[model samples]
Target: MRQKSVLVVGAGLSGAVIARILAIRGVHVCVVEGRNHVAGNCHTVRDQHTGVMVHAYGPHIFHTDDAEVWRFVNRYANFKQFKNQVKAQVGGGVYALPINLHTINQFFGKTFDPNAARAFIQAQTTPVIAPARNFEEQALQTIGRDLYQAFFKGYTEKQWGRAARDLPASLLKRLPLRFDYNDDYFSHRYQGIPEAGYTDMVARMLDHALIEVQLGVRFDRVDARGFDHVFYSGAVDGYFGHSYGRLAYRTLDFETRSYEGDFQGCAVMNYPSADVAYTRITEHKYFAPWESHERTICYTEFSRDCGIGDIPFYPIRLVHEKQMLAKYRDLAAREAGVSFVGRLGTYRYLDMDVTIKEAMQIARTYAKKAGVAALPAALEAAA
Candidate 1:
């Protein structure tokens, strides 16, 4: 009997997990990646000069509340404890991010306890804008104008290349201000980076007899004719040759600098001041604190409008983008023998853990039913 064959597009976490699960279930899988190597954005390589693991695209810290997702990643590679402690570079002073107790006290020059701090911040907020209209208004009503201007206003404008009032109120969905001193960026139960690197971990995930990985190969809809089913993790617009107008995205431009000693004394230092063109500076060596290096590499990240031939990073799912995304999704639903998966496919900003979890679920559903016909929302939503 001929074994069922499946095509997995884009060798990132989503494709890697799906390929592994389906292969384990007795299906033959072919993974094709346009880039010369696998692991897409999460691709990591050791700097020959510094011997430091560099996050080729940007920093990806695996932090998740889901126990299953944590265990799943651990199976591929050993993970080191990595807490993302971020600092913000403002006017003549540095402050802790997420606006915690220390940041509040430092910025205001007041020593207030947690209870007093909460009350003080509450006092600062004015009820001028009821049912806030946009990000700027929502922020002023929640964190007060003083802190909003200092922390969010300029940074938000620089990052999105737009004024705060122009952005959706949903962008600042929750009050980012914290009354406590917990400096950890993410509050998830599991947080860490792979000891070897994400690329190594993903490589292990694709290491199976049933899985065949071909790098530097781009697969189009025509190529789907050779396989029973296709799992595409590439941009939804790219899959259809971008028939509908292109969706808006903010791509990052990194200015890398090599230094003999520590540069910023931290992994990520954000510049909230609009005067500074770049958003943040990330020291790569700090990402893996467990490993020490004499030389360090830092990337000064600049966010701007994504252009042709540029790698899209953040999907700007504003009003216009959302409307355009609907048209692409409608086209995706009509396509046969193919399912769109992952951040680019769904047109949403997704964390690494969520990407892996969704991919695993999709593959498991297919394994249980022994056919793509039984796939879940990841497929049915488009259908």
Candidate 2:
């Protein structure tokens, strides 16, 4: 019998994890990435001038509640305990994010206990008897007008390039409103960043003898002829050449600057006010607190509509996009010997852990059997 050879498209977390798993099972894996380097958007490198590890695409903190996923990443590289304590600069005062007890007290200038804070927030709500109609309604119903305006309204608008009312109510459902002092942005049990950097970790994952990674090489559907099967992690729409139409996605533009000392004093500081064109500023040095760096590098993040030839970040699954996604999914279903995986392939925003977990699952399934199946609703909701 001929050796089972698979072509893995894109060398991001999803592709790397999948490639590693398949290689362990004695499968010949070929990973083709359009970018010159591995790790995709999570690519990290040290600044020659400042000696700070910079998150090339944007700030990506590895956070997950899954124990297996945590162990899997730790196998590759050491991760330091890192908490994403985000701050928002709004209305002349800077406050902690996720609207914790500290934020509530600071914003309203009142010191209240958990129960009292909860009651106060409840009282501030608009008292909508029906379910929330939109993102704005959801915010007003959960945190009330005052807190919503200060923290979410302008920032959400700037990030999505749409009015809060125009966005779906489900968008605000994930945002936690805590009555306690806990200000950690994510509620995950395991949250940290790799000590060596994401690129090093991904490089270790792709280090298997059976795996061959081709950087700066673009692979299309036609190129899957030689391999027995193909695992595609690129844009699903692009796979089919956007026959239906280009799916809507929000891309980020980062303006990086070198600072002599601490710039924002935090990993991420959000500018919620509408006056600010950029949404947030991220200081790279804070991501790895274990390391000492005298100088710092910061990035000012700006969110905008993804144009042609732009790197798509967040998939905007509004009504039109959903319809277009369904059409592309149907096309994928008809296609043979190919499986779509990861954020771009599924057209959803996925965290690092979820991406690795799904990749492992898909790879294991494929290794056990010759036929590989696509992940259905792996991390976040698709389409």
Candidate 3:
């Protein structure tokens, strides 16, 4: 009998993880990536000028509550403890992000305790609207007009290129207005950046003998019939030739600048004012605090609607996009010997941990059904 062969599209976290798992399970995996390098959006490279590890696409801080996922990553590369303490530049002043007690007290010029701060914010909140409907309404009702306008209004408009009133309230669900001094962006059990780099970690994951990684190769060029199973991690709309219409997405443009010394003095600093064209500036050196650098590299991030050739970063899952996504999902379900996985495949923004977890789960499911005659059906069902 011929050995089972699998075609894994996009040699990113999703594809690499899945390929690694399947290869370990005695399946031959061929990993193809459109980009010249692996690790997908989390690709990191050393900046020759500054000798800083630049997050090529953008800053990707690995933070997750899943112990298994954390352990899985650590198995391949060492992760340094890094806390994402984001600073926001609003009203010509720096403030701790996530709207903590220090920010509230500093903004209001009061030494209120957690309870007092909570009460004060509640009072400041819009009392007229009992239940908030949209992002704007929710912001007003939760943090009141002053805080919302100063921090969220302009930034959100620039980020999404849409009024906060037009966005769903669910979008701001994780954005917390804390009463304590904790300024850590995420409340995850684990948070760190890989010591070597994301690309190195992914390369290690694809080091198995059964896994063959072919970079700068488009998925469309591959012959799917050659493989018993195909795992696609590219854009779902692109796979179907966008017959239903392109799904809405936001892409980022980075303006990187080199500095002699410490530039921003922080990993990330948000510009929450309409006056600034860029949303935030990231100092790459700060991402790896363990390493000392005489020079620094910073990137001013600009968000815009994803164009035809632009790389899609965030999915704008509005009502119209949702409708189109449903159509694509239906089309994908009908595809034989193919399974859509990862952020682009599912049309949802996924964290690193979740992506790895899902890939591992899918690969395990495929391994379990390796001997079964109805493997394709089981794989499609799992997807």
lDDT of each: 0.89, 0.91, 0.91
Candidate 1 lDDT over 167-279, as tens digits, reads 97888864366889998888889999999999999999999999999999988778898788899999999988888889989999999999998999999999988889998
| TM-scores for every candidate against the unseen true structure | 0.95, 0.96, 0.95
- Model 2 global lDDT (CA atoms, 0 to 1): 0.91
**Ten residues in a row with the worst lDDT in model 1?**
374-383
Off by more than 4 A, model 2:
371-383
Report the C-alpha displacement of residue 24, candidate 2, in angstroms: 0.3
Candidate 3, 332: how far from true, in Å?
0.6
Off by over 4 Å in 1: 371-383
Deviation in Å, model 3, residue 358 alpha carbon? 1.0
TM-score of 2: 0.96
Per-residue lDDT, model 3, residue 367, is: 73
lDDT string for model 2 (239-353, tens) is: 9988998999999999988877788788999999999999999999999888899899999999999999899999999999999999999988888888899999999999899
Considering only N, C-alpha and C atoms within 3 Å, which residue pairs clash in candidate 2?
none
What's the CA RMSD of model 3 in angstroms? 3.8
